[model samples]
Target chain A: MSEFSVELRDVVKKFPTPEGGEVFAVNHVTMQIKNGEFFSMLGPSGCGKTTSLRTIAGFEWPTSGEIYIEGEPMGHRPPYLRPVNTVFQSYALFPHMSVAENVAFGLEMEKTPKQEIKRRVGEALEMVKLTGMERRNPTQLSGGQRQRVALARSLVKRPKVLLLDEPLGALDLKLRKEMQLELKALQQEVGITFVYVTHDQEEALTMSDRIAVMDGGVVLQVGKPVEIYERPNCRFVADFIGETNFLDGEVRAIDGDRVTVYIPRLKDELVGTKASPVRIGEQVVVSLRPEKTRIIENKAKMGNCFSGKVLNIAYIGSDTRVFVDLGGVSLKVWEQNKISTLDPEAYYERGEQVWVVVMPENALVLHLG
Target chain B: MNPHRRSPLVVVSTALVYFFLYMPIVVLFLFAFNSSKTNILFEGFITQVGPTEIVSGNVIQSPCGPFHWFCELAKNVEVRNATRNTLTIALISTLTSTIIGTFAAIALQRYKFKLRTFSEVSLYIPIVIPEIVMGIGILVLFSQLFTLLNSALSLIGDSQLTLGLTTVIVSHIAFSVPFVALVVRARLHGFDQSIEEAAMDLGANELVTFWRVTLPTIMPGVLSGALLAFTLSLDDFVITFFTTGPGASTLPIYVYGLLRRIVTPQVNALSAVWILIIFVAVFLTQRLQSRQAY
Candidate 1:
């Protein structure tokens, strides 16, 4: 009924605290997830990301405001009446049922014909790469296999949207990563809108078409992974998305799209592009990603460059993380190790003098509040 | 410590504990076949060799009639009546309590309402409060209610109400519900609420979700609770004694009456059979529960 697959309009969900005070779990959260887009709500625990997803799944009814799915208002409708299915974080595969039976449950609930249910269940199991395991009970399956059964169970319904609440969270690290790609590929193949909820930033960034970074029952930023990571709108979004070196400063001057930030720690005026309109007297934080800043043996000819002593050098397989102390403040910089040699001479030594060079276009001017 | 080698102290203590637990039941089973009417001691190791009876000592007059005792018990009218009454009350009460208590447990576990905590705590009252107090309370309640009913009936005709098997069953159900509820509640504690949600989200209604998902998940606990209720009802004497009328005596009450009259080996035979039934039921319940735990 709506252009967007799902929309929440100023939804606020209040939960009673143990002390009897009411706290908003989802406070005035407004967002529209497009049709067939992989939209993720990413945040730390207790930040209302799961609540927002649950609201969309119709598991939670907002205390105030309204929710719409496919242009239709969901007014006190139970989850059974809603046209969406969820793969729960715990897998939630029916332990008593076989994989095929679990997958066919939604179809059976809809009163689908016996032939169609069987055909569709078979197809669904095939889609999840679990064709031969149909007769096996969920309890006999491994964590990843159970997760796939849950996926197949929900996906067989062919609902308007599929909700995944940290479906890969229980798996081991390698399996989680593998499933992350498989889930993205499966979503694209099915062409159904997905509302994925997770606190893992890398997971959100790796698969989502767009991400909504939530904190304190609020949606702080909603944008593509690149836009959210590179040009975060506020301090929390910038820091939470990835490893960012925050330079607290005052806005000294604004020239066109370029703004000069006066940092007392570096005793230097760093120039970067502003994400929003800023006044000269406003306090700003320059969000510089660790990977964006390069450690140079010599001073660069262009951009913001500062000389500092290397505080720590850590070799983390793929890259070398160098922390440099620039007078009063230290900046973390990640440099990819391009060479394959293990020679000691190739690595940067601690306490070595180096220049921290940040590209002006790479630095983002974020609002203090 | 090596896995195979247990310390002597541990082995001795374990053996002592087993002896303390099972010695009485073993003695009861042994004396069920006693040749004499009294069951205090064995009658000089009397032995039966096929048709001809062989005796080790001349002090005994008859052989230990193991099969004869069971045969006499089966023929005894009171024992048969008690057995029938015990089984009937146990089955009816177990069914009633399991159904009512499962619903109560689900409502308490899944929903929040006014007086919810009070209701939850009230369930424990029947379980933890001494059975003697419960028996007296039920007896007083029934007598007062019976008097009130009879007075109302006096308008039409004069009739007196008397406690019977129905009263016994009702009282058994009253105590059985709490034990059932406690067990089902423990099962529900580990139940993943999301599985129910997933069922509903998959378009199954609440009733269907309960039958398809919730019931099957907690079936082991419900069965075990029912078995426990059945055994409790079968072995119950306190409440049954207080509530039962003259002709409605259950097996335990009948056994108590027999013991007061005389310590016949027939009573031991009945007890041995009762103990066997209870052991089988309890063993089956434990097996069912342990299977579900995995």
Candidate 2:
């Protein structure tokens, strides 16, 4: 058995457009998912995240390149021949089958003994905490219950990799948050590789061990959740993962890993860690997260800091987002409300003069090709 | 005005529409037990009879009795044979058409090929084309096909084939296939294809997936299609008329023959019986299709 549970080698999937031209559903993309790792392919809709998951599940064959599961290359293998199962976004549980029967479907297909199938099905349901819902039909179950049944049905097979294409996309917000943690725990409990595809970045960050953020049929960046959020490699990854401010600037000087960029809007030179290679005089974008920047009344600071006026302040539950306008550039700064009070006068008012302070390490320089 | 409030104009119009729709069927059902053999008038009533035979103008006639036409209908040998033929054709044709149409529907709905659009559009041809035209077309095609087969076989032996009950059944199947395909296709339209993929993803092959997942989910559509096809074949008159040779008369054909030659209460009774049977079958099929919708 290979250390990597699944490996996609430069896989590309194309579909014929109505005009007889081919468009790439999944561009040249490659990633290795470790054994028992919860890997997420996170992107917006039509970004080929689902297509990549389907490729690994053998539902869609790549137009080119290879897929290897546990070191064996899958060549023209059908979905049934592969050792993988998918929990569909719609929870595609068979409406006619009971919850127990749906969970036992895969075992029955393998010609397992009837008693063995029953035991495994029972165990699978218990794993998802759906023990007593055996006799209920999928249609009769609530959305969350049906989602669990889907998970139980797929997990019952105990495949090498479990592919989930936005399994929580159908549930409401409260249930979705609950299921996200449950899914992570379940994946760890089963110790099987989970390849999850979703457009919800928060959901991906909350659940995945590592995430491959994709866009326009290409994998932009792949890293741990913190790495993807804090040190995004490109502009797309930085903006897509979380709320960030992009300030267009030109590279001024380079000092090993640190680079100085001149922002015309701020009329100041800021120094930060260079995320990608850049040359002097090359135009780039400095991505700074709203939560990373501090709001200080005094402009005097050791690191990169700017003086600006408070453009607007939004009171969101626990955090207050302040938009500070530094000349032509507007920077969003989030300050957490540690003191629990619903006093509007206590927070920063609009049009107030506030100093925005961003450390050099927090500002990431992103290069565009 | 609130749209939810009932309008008198709408209610009256809907009532008039139903009246126009069902008035003929109601009259035919009521006239089935009209007591008189002659169906032109309602005049052969025994107004003052004493629970026995009636004498009127030196002519003796049997008194009015309940279910008079139905009893006569059950005893008529021609009508009995026609009913038997109708049931036989309907059952065989419904089975054959439903199976074929289900496969056709799955193929049309699920797969993509060069002529997929062409095939999808063509399914509507049989459903939309005039029934008379379709009947005549099938008659010509079957005749030519049988002639070609018989001539080829006769050279080896003297065996020949003729249009009869088999031909009627074939004709019924030909028309019902598209209808069954339509119903099954409609059901498949809302079907989530991921379940089939899920089945396959769970290590079930295509055949197993179809049997365990796909077919069961679409069973309501298949059953409703079969019921509708059965009713269609049973009530068929024009197609059977064109396709049948001799001794293969279905109920509708027999009823048509009775109506053309003689206007009797027996024809009305037979029509009423056919209508009732068709009504029940159609109502059940509609209920099935509506259930499948949710």
Candidate 3:
């Protein structure tokens, strides 16, 4: 068996527009998903995340290049012949069938023995914590319960690679969060490679072992969740993944992986780490996370310190988000609310003069585009 | 001025509309048991007398008590043949049109081709065209085609081509297909396509997915369409008149013939029975649909 559970090598999918020209839904892209890994394709709507997942599932054949499942070429293979099952975003449960029948559908299609199908379906429903819902129709179940049924239906097939297209997207926030943890745990227990697609970054971050961030039919970066959030390789990735304050500047100096960017508005040089190569005098943007910067009383030991006035303060229970103005540039700093206090004066006040400190490692230097 | 409180004019108008719609049917049903043979007057109820008797200088007797006209209708050889023909035509046309129309609806709704829009728009043509015009058109087309086939094969006597049950069934199917397609297409409009994808993802091939998932999901629509087709074929008059030949008369045509001859309560009895059958069929289908609606 191949080490990789699924691989997409230079896959491209084009769809014709109403104006008769074609648009690339999935541009030339490649990905290798290892066995038993929880890999996520994360992007906004129309960024080719779901399209990429569809290609791997054999619902769509690539316009060019190839897809391989377990080292076997899947050229023009129909979805039924492919050893992959998808949990649709809509939780496409069969309304006509009972829960057990829905979960047993795959086994029945394989013409498995009736006794075996019953046992497997029971076990699958048990895994989803819906063991007693065998007689309930899909329409009678709640949205979250239906989502679990969809999961159980696909998992009962025991596919080599399971494709999930925003399986928890229709659920409430609390349910979605719970399902995310449950799905991660289930993947670990089953030892099956999971290719999850979602536009929700936090869901992807909390569940995926590795995430491929995509935008405009292109994958911007692929890495662990921490690496994607902390050291995004481009402006889109840095802006899309989390809350980041961007400062447009020109590269001033390069020292190994560290680079100095001169911001015209601040009239100061901000030193940060660069993931991609940049030369001196090249235009770049520095991405500084809100939580990475701190409001310090003194700027003595700070590497990149700026004297600014607090423009606004939003107290969101756990953290106080402070928007600061340093000269003509605006920056955001998040301060943890460690002390439990009812005093209104404990947080930063508007128009209060504060010094913001951004550590060199916390700042990310990325290409301007 | 409250929205829920209807005005006097609205209530009267609604009552008038229903009265106008159902008064004729109620009259026809009541007349089914009229003791007068001429059906010009209601002498008395058929069940008032157990045996033939003269009362107040009027001879009163019911051939079959309260079911006099119904028994007459059942015993008439021509009406029996007409009923058989109607049912055979209705059943055959309904089944054929349902299968063909479902295929058309699926193709139009699910697939994209060069002529897809044209094909979809054409389905509405048969529905919008007048029934009389469709009847005439089918009649002319069949006559011309039969002429050509007869000359080509040189058929004679029993081998000769002519309009009969086959022609009536074909014409019914032609008109019924569009209604079935439209109804089924309406159902398909709200369908989520990913359900089929889920079935395929579960290792079901296209045929299996359709049988196990797609057909059952859209079955209510198909059944309702088939019911509409069956009713259309059963009661059709204009097309059946133009297409029916010797020994192929249906119930409606037979009733029209009876109206020209001696008017009898048997006609009322047939119509009353027809209405009852339709009501029972509709009620049973509604019950079945509600039971499946979980």
Candidate 4:
């Protein structure tokens, strides 16, 4: 448990093309997954997230470099020999086998005694909350039931690492949301290293202890979910992990820890933290969260404030999204809902002028380019 | 679709075609127990009701003896020999073709490498070429081999591939392999490769996965193809005609000889029996294969 569950060093995988030449699926990816940590690889489709997972699962071998599990070098071993089990996205449950049979397959292969196999199978079913449904065929179950069976099948093995490749991607939105929390709880309860992969950002953000945001065969950032969301290092990370408005401006003044920047259209001096050290007049991108911006009816205590036209106002359930057109740039502001809107609080309609303000500390200057 | 509308077009058309196709066979089947000494049964110009127990639309009973028909059929030695020969050849050829054809299908379908497509195309070549051409090819090859070796040994006749059990079996296998390969390969193309991979991932080796997972999935296709190949081999005439010798006479050959002479009731009875067996075999196969695409 103290060792790294899985370690890949400079791993490279290439696939041959029909017309000729090789396409590098994973180009020199070096990642280390810690024991008992839930790590997720997130990216768009065909971006090599699946390829990387398959490579680690031993179904596909890395064209170059070494992979180790629990400090033991595992070199191109077949899937059966690897101390890992994968719950595939499609659930991949045996259609002909009943639930108990599918869950007991690995134990049967290990030639466990029949009584022990039955007992363990029963326990595994209970762990997945599928105890009473053991005799049902996989075809008779719903999508979520099949997924639970798949999880049971993999979990009962007690592998060093459980590789789950988009296991909840097929379910409906409601089911997917429910399963996200279930999976997180399950991982915590079992205390096993879960290598999960999904393209959904919210699912990864909510479920993973640490998230690896990947795109185009490269991992851009890896950190705790909150850290990655709050302190995104670059434009790609900022845009991928959460909603962020880019305030394109040049640094006017540079000093210790803080700098004053002039937004051209807003005509306001915006103060932001120096994430990357830059020259006094160098151009930098400020990633400002919409939720951080406030609507100032009169005047408010803030670092930077400016007047704008309230171009649009959308009423979400718990909050209202207001789009303020400050000159040429339209900034977004999220206002919390209140029941005491009897006076309507001098509601601003389209083409109405208003003031949008933000605190310097909350406005993040994250990237240079 | 409507009760008021009166159109028996489909039923009338089908009945006409059915009678046209099966009238002779049905007549022959009926006469097998018709108590007639000869094959021809309705041998009267007009028996104009001196023995009248007939209504306008009633069936007229034929005046024939029952003992002669049954006893004569039972006592026919040629009929007995031909029936035995037919059954033995059909069963043996079917069994041989199935074994060889299944092996051929597996080899040709599973692998891809140098000259594999060419080899597959060559297998199909035997199917497309005229049967007489194939028969002639077999005859020439056997004759040349026998002449070369027999002359050297001062022998008169008899070679390994000459018209006997071995030659018939070999010829059937050659003709049937391609059909089996065609059917099995088509089924294999749609087979899910992941199931095999999953079996392997669960600690089964390649051989174990193939035998347990892959083979069972494609078994129905192989069996269906084997049934087709068996029927083809049993009914084969042209190729068997050239390859078979006197001792290796098959059912078709025996029937052909019987037909060349006088048309005996024994021949009709034998034809009815063979037809019944074919119908039953086809019916059972269809029952097993109901609605399955393969």
- Top DockQ: which candidate number? 3
**Chain A TM-score for each candidate, in the given order?**
0.97, 0.97, 0.98, 0.93
Per-prediction TM-score, please?
0.92, 0.90, 0.96, 0.82
What are the clashing pairs of model 2? Answer: none
Clashing pairs in 3: none
Cα lDDT tens digits for candidate 2, B147-239: 898887763433467789999998899999999999899888889999999999988888889998999889988997898798889888888
Select the stronger candidate by DockQ from 1 and 4.
Answer: 1
Off by over 4 Å in 2: A301-303, A338-349, B1-23, B42-72, B145-158, B279-294
Writing each residue's lDDT as its tens digit, candidate 2 over A235-340 gives 9999998899989999999999899999989889999889988899999999989999888877774758788999888989889999999877778889998898
Regions of candidate 4 where Cα sits further than 4 Å from its true position: A249-270, A273-284, A298-307, A326-332, A338-348, A366-369, B1-28, B31-163, B278-294
How does candidate 3 fare on TM-score? Answer: 0.96
Rank all candidate structures by their TM-score, best first, as comma-separated numbers: 3, 1, 2, 4
Give RMSD (Å) of candidate 1 vs. truth: 3.3
Candidate 2 TM-score, true structure as reference: 0.90
Model 1 misses residue B47 by how many Å? 9.1
Candidate 2: residue B294 lDDT (0-100)? 41
Off by over 4 Å in 3: A342-346, B1-11, B47-59
User: In model 1, what is the error at residue B172, expressed in angstroms?
Assistant: 1.1
DockQ of 3: 0.85
Give stretches of model 1 more than 4 Å off: A299-303, A339-347, B1-3, B38-66, B112-114, B155-159, B290-293
Better of 3 and 4 by TM-score: 3
